[model samples]
Structures are given as C-alpha cells and as structure tokens.
Target: VANKGLKDLKKQVEGAAQDAVTAVGAAAQQVVDQATEAGQKAMDQVAKSTQETIHKSANQASESFSGFGKKLGLLK
Candidate 1:
C-alpha cells in the first residue's frame, strides 16, 4: 500500500511539471507573436519613410539631369 501511494504521488508530480512546462511554452509563444507584430508595424513605417525619401531624391535627381541636358543642347 505504501509503495502504491508513492507511485501515485510521483505521477502527480510529473503531471504538474509537464503542465508547468506547457504553460511556459504557451506564454513564450504569445510573447513572440506580439513582438513579431510590433516589429512588422515598425518595419512598415520605416518602409514608408524610405519610399518617401527615395521619391524626393529621384525628383531632385531628375530635375538636375534635365537642367544638364538643356545646357548640353539636348533638350529645350
């Protein structure tokens, strides 16, 4: 009877340990998901800013190129 009681107690402890591990894993996954979402949001904002910068730079470069072409008598 004592040996059987010890076996039951061991099983209960093992089960609780497994449950705790599963909970930790679930919490970590939630954190990772949230972080990924935040990172993607930040990346999107950066991309927008970069695109705007590139567009402005391209406009300025084209204007300069057009001026140069006019000076070279290639364009009116």
Candidate 2:
C-alpha cells in the first residue's frame, strides 16, 4: 500500500511547508521594519536641521529689531 510505504511522509511534508512559510514571512517583516526605521531616522535628522535654521533666523531677527528699537528710544 502507498500509505504503508510512506506512513509519515504526509506529516513531514506538512511540517516542511509550515517552516518555509514562516521563513518567508519573517524575511518580509524584517524588510518592512528596517525600512521604517531608516525612514524615521531620516525624518529626525531633517527636523533637527530645520529647527537649527529657524533658531538662527529668529536670533538674527530679534537682534535687528532690538537695534531699531534702541534707535527709536523704545528700548534701553
């Protein structure tokens, strides 16, 4: 009988199939996680640079306004 010749073959095939599916799923998940992490890091760097630029511009604008205020006798 074929079943007698391959008594445990069905179970073995099922286990192998399960392992292959798990491996593929893990690989795909890893790719998505890495991409997300990279995107977050890039966004953080851009935000920091923009903040620095805005801070510098604000400082310069405040200094210019103060100088004008002193000329107008509005600031000591």
Candidate 3:
C-alpha cells in the first residue's frame, strides 16, 4: 500500500514539472515574437526615411541643373 502511495506521489510531481516547463516555453516564444515584430517595424521605418531623402535629393539636383542650363542659354 505504501509503495502504491509513493508511486502516485511521483506521478503527480512529474506532471507538475511538465506543466511548468510548457508554460515557460510558451512565455519565451511570446517574447521572441514581440522582438521580431519590433525589429521589422524599425527596419520599415528606416527604409521609408531613406526613400524620402533620396527623393528630395533628386528634386534638388534637377532644379540646380535646370537653373544652370538657363544661365548658359542652353534651354529657353
């Protein structure tokens, strides 16, 4: 009877340990997902800013060339 009781106790302990490990694994995965999402957002913002900068630079260069062409009488 005592052996049976000890076996039951061992089974309960193992079940509890398994539950804790599963909970911890789920929490860790959530953290990793959040970090990945945040990194992607940062990269997207950087790409947008870079595109805007390139557009502005291209406009300034075009205007400068147009003005130079008029001064040289190359364009009417």
Candidate 4:
C-alpha cells in the first residue's frame, strides 16, 4: 500500500510539472504575438506617412511648374 501511494504521488507531480511547462509556453507565445502586432502597426503607420509625404511633394512640384509656365507665357 505504501508503494502504491508513492507511485501515485510521483504521477501527480509529473502531471503538475507538465502543466506548468504548457502554461509557460502559452504565455511566451502570447507575448510574441503582441510584439508582432505592435511592430506591424508601426510599419503600417510609417508606410502611410511616406505616401502622404510623396503626394504632398508631387502637388507642390506641379503647382510650381504651372506658375513657371504662366510667367514664360507658355500657358494661360
């Protein structure tokens, strides 16, 4: 009977250890997922900002050229 009790205790300890490991792994994965999501959002913002800058620069260049053309009497 004592030997049986010891065996049962060993099994319980092993099961608990496995559960702890699984929980730790899940927590680590969650951290990684959050980090990846944050990085993607930052990248998206940078891309949007870059597109806006390019659009603004193009508009400025077009307006400047139009003004120059008028001054040269090449455009009405």
Candidate 5:
C-alpha cells in the first residue's frame, strides 16, 4: 500500500511539470509571433519609404536635365 501511494504521487508530480512546460511554451510562442509581425510591419514601412525616395530623386534628375537641354537650345 505504501509503494502504491508513492507511485501515484510521482505520477501527479510529473503531470504537473508537463503542464507547466506546456504553458511556458505557449507563452513563448506568442511572444515570437508578435515580434515577427512587428518586424514585418517595420520592414514594409522602410520599403515604402525607400521607393518614395527613389521616385523623388528620379523626378528631380529628369527636371534638371530638361532645364539644361532648354538652356543649350536643344529642346527649344
């Protein structure tokens, strides 16, 4: 009877430990998912800003060249 009690106690302890590990794993996964989502959003914003800068630079260069051509009497 004493040995049976010991065995049952050991099983209960193991089950509790497993439950704790599962809870910790789920919490860690949630943190990782949130970080990934935030990183993706930041990357998207950076990409958009980069594209806008490129477009503005291109427009400025085109306007400058056009003005130079007009001054040279090349485009009238």
Candidate 6:
C-alpha cells in the first residue's frame, strides 16, 4: 500500500514538472517574437531617416551649384 502511494506521488510530480517546462518554453518563444518585431521596427526607422538625410543633402548641393553657375554667367 505504501509503495502504491509513493508511485502515485511520483507520477504527479512528473506531470507537474512537464507542465512547468512547457510553460517556460512558450514564454521564451513569446519573448523572442517581441524582440524580433522591435528590431525590425528600429531598422525600418533608420532606413527612412537615412533616405531623408540623403535627399536633403542632394537638394542643398544642387542649389549651391546652380547659384554658382548663375553668378559666373554660365546660366541665366
């Protein structure tokens, strides 16, 4: 009778441990997904800012050269 009781206890402990492991695995996956999404958003913002900066610089350079040409009578 005591042996049977011990066996039942062991089974319960094993089942609980398995459940805990499954819960931890699921939580870890959620954390990984969140981090990946955040990283992608940051990358997108960086790309947009870089493109805007490049366009602004190009416009400035074009205006400067056009004004210089007009002053030298190379352009009307």
Which whole-number lDDT from 0 to 100 does residue 58 have in model 3? Answer: 100
Provide the RMSD of all predictions against the true structure, rounded to 1 decimal.
2.7, 2.0, 1.1, 0.9, 1.4, 1.3
lDDT of 2 by residue, 11-40 (tens): 888899999999999999999999999999
Q: Candidate 6 residues 1-76, lDDT tens each?
A: 9999999999999999999999999999999999999999999999999999999999999999999999999987
For 1-76, candidate 3 gives per-residue lDDT tens digits of 9999999999999999999999999999999999999999999999999999999999999999999999999977
**Clashing residue pairs found in predicted model 6:** none
**Per-model tally of clashing residue pairs:** 0, 0, 0, 0, 0, 0
Show the colliding residue pairs in model 2: none
Those runs of model 5 whose alpha carbons end farther than 4 Å from true positions after fitting are none
Candidate 6, residue 3: the lDDT equals 100
Error of 5 at 70 (Å): 1.5
Off by over 4 Å in 4: none
Write model 1 residue lDDT over 17-66, tens digit each, in one string.
Answer: 99999999999999999999999999999999999999999999999999
lDDT of 6: 0.99
For candidate 1, the TM-score is: 0.71
Lowest lDDT sum, 10 consecutive residues, model 3, at 67-76
Q: Model 4, 1-76: lDDT tens per residue? A: 9999999999999999999999999999999999999999999999999999999999999999999999999988
Cα-based TM-score, every candidate: 0.71, 0.76, 0.90, 0.92, 0.85, 0.86
Clash count, predicted structure 3: 0
Pick out the ten consecutive residues of candidate 5 with the lowest summed lDDT.
67-76
